[model samples]
Target: MGNCCVAGASSDMATFKWSIDNFSSLLDKGEGWTNSRVFKIMGHAWHLKLNPMDRNSCDEECVSLRLQLSKTSVEPNTIVDASFRLIIYDQLYGKDSEHHVSHTFQTASTSSGKSCMIKLAALKNSSGFLVNNNCVFGVKFIKVVTTKAKTTSEKLFVKNASTLPEAKAAYTWCIADFFGMENPGYSPEFTAGGYKWSIRLDKEENHISLYLKKMINDLPEDSAVLVEFTLSIKNQEGGKHLKKKGLTQFSNNDPTWGWEKVVSMEDIQDSSNGYLIKTKCCIEAEVTTVGSSKMK
Candidate 1:
């Protein structure tokens, strides 16, 4: 016997070739014996059997071939899905004779393999298949790949943040105070995505910093949340806003995210920039957060 391998685009495909000597004598075995070989492909074992002629089936001119997967090591009677093809190659002229019948193997099947037959007279009458008493046979099995549907989380907040149902005063800092402030102030709290969130204005020199805080008051220990949001410094005079978008996970110890300098102190104080409306500034946030056990 001879062996050969064929490569396909996906690493999943397995192709095998077998050569036979004294080809005519093997066919004379009839139903008494079948020429078969066990081979591994796509992580499973399969059987390929060939009969030279079907003289017992009232058709001496026909030949038979079978392709079957070995009993699996998986659970008893496990359903193994597969797709494959079997061919009796005509090596003399390089023309491969496709049996052209059925070759699909699936889970819902009652059997594990497929069998095909062709007229020996047609094969011989063609060319190159049975030459010098030697012939080649081959089988190709395809790998099936499956993927799950992707899921995404989303949220919406009322335009009036002051009336937000789960909101608390996330943070407040004396706008003009800088030197003595070392930490974020008390924040306004709200819930989105499966976690509590807060917004804080940190007092910093020359700039007003902001942050979204993960509220831990009622949170379970080691809790984590995935947060996605867009924060904007809305210009009350004009709509040319300063905006930022981000996605990150917030854990108990690191629950905040925001701009360190939302707008420069110089930009904030500029009258023509639409940033200060009679000394009052406008801030806006659109957020979506979720409870996530795995992150990528």
Candidate 2:
């Protein structure tokens, strides 16, 4: 009897060639695989089987191959310097896989405050063996630079108005003394021209409108004055009482000085009431105090 030629030997060789051709095609289509495809094998020593192709089968096979590739291809968090080379290889076969996809890239270098790009290239043999067979791919990089640290300045306060005797006394004793101990960042200085202090204030509507002027040592030209006037009621018997003394009044009708009108007092408390009150007066001064550092 004449010896029978193996049924799959020729076809298997042809299929292998086809697989290589498909891989070459991938390299030509760009640097990477467009998508992965999978297949099943069922051919033992004697028993025969048929493999089918479908969406589910393809997805399962592709995912498995990709997982294998990812595990063996690259290390996580690999710090690459500028202009360094990379090499990717198919783990399934020691030889370059049938897919000509690039397995390596070069990282570009950049300056402290600039950006950089990475380039990729396909694997190839020096011999004319794989030339013109879609065995290589390449990519270009544009900008490459290192990251930079941001720079900022500390808070600075500027003087806004000339210092007066009363204003200076109030600031030195009440504001300066109080804040100097509590907040050392605040810089309070006095010179022949005037006393000046610095405070950090952000750009907020409430801060700008209400607190800004009061915190600084200057007032606007058309600014109205605000003052806190306290009335002390003492009886001849040496006891002080608000109910017996009744209400204290200061108004524009006063002979000594009269610019503001104390309309009324609704809530009355008999307590010490030694509160530093604030009222609008004709004379106004800008007050400023250093705030906390914005960066920290």
Candidate 3:
């Protein structure tokens, strides 16, 4: 029978060469190949076997594996679907263990890829999955995987504003301060819109607090007042560029008073160290004149 031999060096034994050739006629005779040929085949299968003589040797020989998706430029807060497959080949047994892992991609809100908004699922070994120092890892070799990129929109409450008519009774406007619970501030210019206002207090010392006061006077009862603004929180020291979404709801007792509950602010962003806050507010009120004094 016609035969062709393919020759190459073993992966670990560059000094030694080997070959594979068709040998159907010899196999049909119920006879094995020569011993030298068998040895060469064995060498081809396992060119190198790790050896550990001590703890240090074991550490040095231990194989650490990782898999990563091709890098792409993504916009902030954009959601992407990603999936991957990995094959762990145990050379000693000449067998492969298959693993599947997947994640939805979200642009880093802070610290480039340091944190992801999507929750990762489909891991074969739970303990092997880690998000240490912004590095994501999977065990063994990665192969035959697929990912779909998708974009999703999330609604974030920015802030609150209040507009009152010329005649005002008690112009009670609710504004939520979501500026990094630690360093809340009123901007120098009300560029955000709808009001010429002053901050009652810069920061809330303890629990989130809000106080109500009359901004204007004509002594009217229940004047229509509109409140609107944006809520924001600073990212980690180096992640100041990530944009965060904010939401606010009116507190129960004081409809005109707004304060974010601590628990609700948990997932605002993947923050290394910082406080999250919400924008709270109330609906507009109708005005009625109470005192007979026109001071304007």
Candidate 4:
């Protein structure tokens, strides 16, 4: 910024008017002598430079004026996309000479940030400039905004997830506890896929049998929840564990879903195998659910 005055603003865009009472003496100060002010527009700080005398790219006989964005005010990309209109008021004729611009403005190294609408010559008795030693200018910025919408077409949203140790579901039944059973089977309810779920041992069957169950009422038509998981019997000796991969879904009539017979009782009861350890066994499920809903 050079020699200039900062004043109060009016209306939407910023406006500046300067009256050089000693116009002849100001121009004589030097060619590089500029009158500039640091102003804010569109939430960004900028400099409005008015060079009465000629500068590098400006002609000797013309008055050079332009706008520049301050370095600290720009975003990280070092580029600004904007649309603006600059105005130069010819005070002598009461008509404004305006230039409209809309483009992507780059950083300081790529551009000088100079937007000059006009270069008023020092013409005596001219209608284009210098009305009683007064000059006026204005700048207006146009803003852009964006919005998002939903579609009916199915969209897949995937995320990586894991279960915490504190939330793990495990249960062990002794021989006496198994014989004195009251319900259909032994089961422990847990939470997964943002809903209540459980893994159960099929009590009515004589052989090795289990199933996964989801507790939920009827959902909206075309809305479904599919859960894929691996249920494994934890091993103590670090040998390969007995694991079964299964997938289940939530529907109106049937919520309990899983394989009817996954393993045989003979293989599971073998003490040498890792499935039964110290008369205690454990079960773990790694679950991932994908829910789809029809968009209206």
Candidate 5:
């Protein structure tokens, strides 16, 4: 029989070493047993078992190694998900042999490991494995997965889900250097109901792109607002303005909504249309309806 020394133990990983002091005697006597001390990891206790001459193997030269839960430390009906590595160290050479596997331990007796870790003949033949009368076997817990089951439910009851009141507002922004400005332009922030809003303007392939953005930094998670609005490019020469109407829901994930082609670039470039004049342009947003929610 041999003894094991627990090197270190942690929540996610642990290591231990088993030493056979009299290697020649174990090989000659055969059928020897060894086990390690209890080691706790992630609130679970574990230990290792080694057999010098595995009775379960057809080949007499083979050995068996297993990782088991400490029966005294485990609770009834407890389950553990884990992965580990069994290692045979070479004392002389740096070449080490290892076997890795995963298992689900459902009971106190349930164990996970290799039945045939290595052959005793190979261990004796290798110079690095067996030095003098000493041999080393090791185990490393690579992962320990813990699962928690929670049970609960929540519901928000609104007295009138479809009859909430609507709010309306409008804002207009003027850009002095329209032609010399950047590709994307932003309007000043405005308040509408409980939320702040802004307008974004960009140049799309030969057209103008406009979007309405809902500021969500101050809002709580899962908050959403339904809005109906109009985006327009004002005709600087006092002609009819070009406009697009839209209706959409605004949430954290989808904070902005708009059209890529609100008005063609040809219309703005043409002097006869009067959409742009003296390097200046105007943009307007009319939030016609904003649906809000009330919590009880």
Candidate 6:
């Protein structure tokens, strides 16, 4: 059982748009502002605020727009580094109005935008902006910095194996009380590549975390083992088995490597999924030691 895919970090831009119909009706509602349906960008919830009339006395002839981060979505004191563009589409003609902002949003600076987005007279002029009582607005997120920082240990694990060994071994562990099992359940030690190895499962709140651990003791300092492996949970009733693959180095200082969420507990608990049958389940690991070395 050596199976799982290599994992890494990624950062990509994201976008969102909002459209409103009956544009003229919003002005008659007497409400100073209205909000768009909530949407998400990289897991953070946000929404657009459209004010029919500008908030400032000097900009009364213009409409204002703002991008607001959802209070319930972000934690207190958390900071979000963001860059985005706000757009007001010209429905009839193709001339769109745009505004761009790059700022770190926090507790006090959760909203950002332009106070004078478009002139009320020009928007209602029956030209490009408002057509057939319809209007459109959009936001494109240029960046959203995540809080989690990748660790040096993960970098050491993703390196490609210098050489490949045809040798590989697979082992399976069966559990009697699947859900009732304590935090970590270890598989019997199995031999692979002249080293004893075992599978470890920690029952987390939402996932069954999996890890491949070396079970040997040695004297060599600065020693490391290059391994390629896959960890999986079998579907007892003939369903597709959940599996993941990984390639990493196992050293004296770091004897284990695997995913924090190999398979979710939700999938394991569903009876029809066949992951658990009569309170019993199976876990497997396929391991291969491509190479190993010791510091000179």
TM-score of each: 0.40, 0.18, 0.24, 0.38, 0.45, 0.44
Model 4 lDDT tens row, 212-254: 6676665666555666767776664678877777655565556
Q: Who wins the TM-score comparison? A: 5
lDDT of 5 by residue, 30-119 (tens): 686667767666567787777777754465667778888778655555567788888878887778778897887765446775557778
TM-score (C-alpha, index-matched) for candidate 5 = 0.45
| Model 2 residue 55 CA deviation in Å | 33
Off by over 4 Å in 2: 1-24, 27-83, 86-287, 294-296
Q: Is candidate 2 or candidate 6 better by TM-score?
A: 6
Ranking of predictions according to lDDT? 6, 5, 1, 4, 3, 2
Question: What are the per-model C-alpha RMSD values against the true structure?
Answer: 14.3, 22.8, 21.3, 16.8, 11.4, 17.9
Q: What is candidate 6's CA lDDT for residue 24?
A: 81
TM-score of 3: 0.24
For lDDT, candidate 1 versus 6, the one ahead is 6
lDDT of all predictions: 0.59, 0.23, 0.28, 0.55, 0.75, 0.75
Predicted candidate 6 versus true structure: per-residue lDDT over 238-265, tens digit per residue:
8788888998878888898888976778
**What lDDT tens digits, residue by residue, belong to model 2 across residues 107-211?**
221111111111122234322224443222111121122233344444423333353334422222223222123321232432212223222212221211101
lDDT of 3 at 154: 35
Of candidate 1, the 10-residue stretch with the lowest lDDT total is 168-177
TM-score of predicted structure 4 = 0.38
